[model samples]
Target: MPDFPFDAETHRRRRERFLQETGGGVAIFCALPELVKSRDTEIRYRPDSDLFYLTGFTEPGTVAVLTPHDEEHGFTLFVRPRNPEREVWDGPRAGPEGARERFGATAAYPIAELDERLKGLLEPADAIFYTLGSDAAMDRRVTELLRGFRLTRPRSGKGPADVRDPSIILDRMRTIKEPGELDQIRASAAIAARAHAAAMRMARPGIGEWELEARVESTFRASGPTAGTAFPTIVGSGTNATVLHYVDNARRTEDGDLVLIDAGAALGLYCSDITRTFPVSGRFTPAQREVYEVVLAAEEAAIAAIKPGAPFTDIHEAARRVLVQGMIDFGLVTGTVDEVIEAKAHQRFFMHQTSHFLGLDVHDVGAYATADGSPVPLEPGMVLTVEPGLYIPAADDVPERFRGIGIRIEDDIIVTPDGHEVITRAVPVNPDEVEALVGTEQAHTETQRHGGEG
Candidate 1:
């Protein structure tokens, strides 16, 4: 058997914490079901983030049940049974016996027995903790089980009365990363940094956008660590850069155009998201440089404000202030910085929030606001992304020099005791540094070609 990234004890501690947080309840988690892509094909299987966080098992059709405060058995797992025929088509399964032996489950059973056995488990629970509206099939099954239990409650005096979403407790626990989780995230950042660097080196005026995407993705996969992309790679160039979340990487790069590549890699299920915009010709034009500098300054301001106990909104405010002031200075807006911000005038260029919780999911779990709907304070072990961008459309209202120029600078940051650390700092974001890096690579490629001819 392959060595898992996390040990069994780590999962045990997580389950214990979940139980304590929920007091005494039966918490159920279902793994992601396989989705069909075509008549006989299926999309690649990726485990659900929440399920994988609590239990490291990645196979489909697996379900985990946690009975807190139960003396006999606190953890039970239902897994696919081992079969030679199925193993021939698909890969091998952990099976019920392997689940008990490898995953530290107190009891294990074949998944075929879930419907029959789950009812008995639900009959004695006072409260149920499950993720609702996730899997429709699983949702129906759970509802039917609860309905049966409720119908029999007249005589047995059992079954849960309260149903709560497990994310309430699970999200909080996941917000604070453990040392192991940090290590995984840091490794992911390192791989993504290298991939971005590769993309920068390969970018040229005549290259197709998909070529750069291929280079970055190949580097990510070749570097190991399960070799998966955190999300679809974004390699937008020129006018395409203005569209946020643009994944159609089919455009060709042109001279004097800026390319924005927002891509990341996953290592041990942790993700690293990064975005860097650089000139396709290896040096930024005067117009591109001006906008790039503003976005970089905004990103820096946001990152500098990240500290323990600081309100989460502080980061966004710092970035917004810088961006609004830049817009005023560039004559993009008429009002003063404060006036523009108050009047919501900056949304024309700088739109999205400066930061988001980053972890297993690119936009990871965790509530941004408190009970009263105020921004939550930062805490140690929390990881986030500091991304600030400026996008100018080619319109009559926009200044001709800055029009059609979109630039964004982003980095992955981790909150620490005294300050914060940028894990994705390997790639150059400074204008001069980026120019030199790309120029050096371009020169090297030309020299190699001449040398080969000689």
Candidate 2:
């Protein structure tokens, strides 16, 4: 019910661009397949993000073909057929008839006829563009079809053509998002920001970390059914926060500890990723404040370098400098910033890059390769997350005051022609602003009404 109608115009334009790049080859893309949870049970189904981005069609068992080579036949779509009996349990699908008219496909066919139909479409084309080896079932089907086509003899016998990577052409187009996509991503980031704020306000001693995850998810769901979390929520407290990919969220919050919340909300298929570390008691202790400020400074520095024409690696290096300097200041290391970075000493507390591209997936895809197939450059319309973290595990080498203190500050940002735009501003990151947002009487009222926090 929360799904929006498929935008025909968008699909048409996307096909046009892909066709132009392929120069008359056939491109094959499949919808994400459903997964099973247990015996006779299935997990919630979400369509593949790439397929959804182009067609806005989230239904299963769909395949799209863009042909730039064969002028006579192009833009073919394959979909499921209507079956009332199955519709009673699942749902009615847009059959071939509806797909051709609604999606601007040159022709449409039932998925059942994929093998029979694909053979003819594959011929006359110079090359086949596909994500080969990605889906073993689809791959096997395609291979079998190709093998059969090769054996069959037409009145004028000919063999099948070659296969190529469609990513080479499509990745270039998907890298720069359109205006509509940017708008959706911005809205998603705002929702995620509010969700992070809600989690901070609800965090408290005596409550399990999972309670904070619930609060974060509840804020997203309250917005709309489509506004559920984009990924698994990470609500880690104390030493657990030191684990970068922590997602269990089962530990209990305790007095004098900081909670690290990494979460996001999905709005209209667009996603936003955000992480904020705040005090569980609504105020940071001296040690917690010290580490949080350092991470915040590095995050700000990383974001400041997000301008057009700047290298994506530049931002990472900038944040690295800040973290290295902080490490020296805290007496965790004994060297200058350059010396520490060269020696790779910063890996002790900071282990990952400052940011990565964020869009449909948390780590969106594109031609990360340079023009010569090396590292790519930053450009406008690219959205990325600037997250800088400092994690100090409990160890003898670490200063006693710095032990078990971990902090990460993250925000979603968009590159502009001149500079960048911070999309997740709704979530306060400042020490004072975060304290104020979580310390209000309204927050306490909600916590009390929830029957002892969770």
Candidate 3:
């Protein structure tokens, strides 16, 4: 079986692009190390996004070397040798043989030979493209190799003269999604949309946050055509929603609380991120709907602003303007929209940026700005997320009804020739649809209790 679903040609194209950007530089990629959760239990292993993106090989104990100009070994793999004994316990491996034949490596060797083999690959290169700080052992090996090469420079007189971060080349490539990558992300978005709808239908007072998390994740697992979550599933309710990055999911939702779910699924390593906030009581209170409307408007406006040639920050600015005005209208801050935005006074309620590059990683790989420090222009094939949120703490200064409320609406978007497509609309983002969907299970249970007579 192939380690990844993508055909070797798909990866070849990406690598070709990377090499073109690097101008035939030597590059090194080390797969992530498997981690131990505790004594003998191992955490589920995932490949580094960059390595997986370039090579479509998702194995640990592997390193890939790219010498772009060397036709014979332009792309080399150093990987774990297949062992029957270990396979019985830890599952199958794509061994070095598979590396070349299955994954399209020009040359392959056992990982044990990397130190001996890598020296030759780096000797004639003028520049090296490698990111440090991923693996300590790999960092040391590369540093020592560079030192040794420096010592031998008088004799050989040829070695890598500069080391550049691969992200400089990779970020640009990843930001613009290829057709295949966009397909994967679209599939991922569909799964996440279904999962969100499932969770929303089941939401009701007295439900545990963890239950919502499980419902959404179970939907991802059962409906996959997916690898797993893009990141940890968040099911924050009430005040917890105000605390960004809250993944505890231990609290029991009370009536009228708003549940903020920020979840995404990984489909063939590409990802979809979506966030939807809905009321727990089956219907949103006037205040909850009012707050949610602001966020929805902001999210919609931001997504609408995504078009070819528009700077990426245009989306942020559009969303920020809406949020700032919403804050002003709500009296959360006392100023005009422009005044509030200029002072960043509304950031207290909406602390995060409105959009981010979305694809392989949740945040994905992309530079927000050009080398000149200006925002990058949006182009066809770019995928991103438009999420706008407001969090009002239960503070004495806040209006009583607005306090303890948090709302965020997010959708995955793809930039197209004319404009953008919002892929995550499979699930409802409109407040009416959200209200109609939330607590459907509870309502159905009630109808059953009454013998189908409402």
The whole-model lDDT of each prediction reads 0.88, 0.81, 0.89
Model 1: lDDT to the true structure: 0.88
Lowest summed lDDT across 10 adjacent residues in model 1 is found at 1-10
Tens-place lDDT per residue, model 2, 1-454, is 2565347898678777777887646788898887999997987777777676666667788887766655555777788887889888987777877777766677888888887777778776666788887678778877876676567636535435567887787666767878888988888888888888877766667778988899888888888767778889998899989999899999998888888899988877678999998887878888788888888888888999889888788889889898899999999998899899889988989999888777777787775557776557889999889999999999998889989998989899999999999999888999988877764545668768897756
| TM-score of decoy 2 | 0.93
Better of 1 and 2 by TM-score: 1
Query: Best candidate per TM-score, number?
Result: 1
User: How do these models rank on TM-score, best leading?
Assistant: 1, 3, 2
Candidate 1: residue 262 Cα off by (Å): 0.3
Give the better candidate number (2 or 3) by TM-score. Answer: 3
Candidate 2 or 1, higher lDDT: 1
> Residue 144 of model 1: what lDDT?
83
lDDT of 1 by residue, 1-454 (tens): 2344798889889988888887767988999888899998999888889888887888899889888756555888898999999899997888988888888888889999988888777667888898888878778978887787779888989888767999999999999999899989999999999999988888888889999999899989897748669999999899899999999999999988899999989877789999999998888888889889999999999999999999999999999999998899888998888899888899999889999999999999999999999999999999999999998998889889988988888899999999998999999999998987764567798999999999
> What TM-score would every model get versus the actual structure?
0.97, 0.93, 0.96
Give the Cα error of residue 425 in candidate 3, in Å: 0.9
Candidate 3 residue 105 Cα shift, in angstroms, is 1.3
TM-score, candidate number 3:
0.96
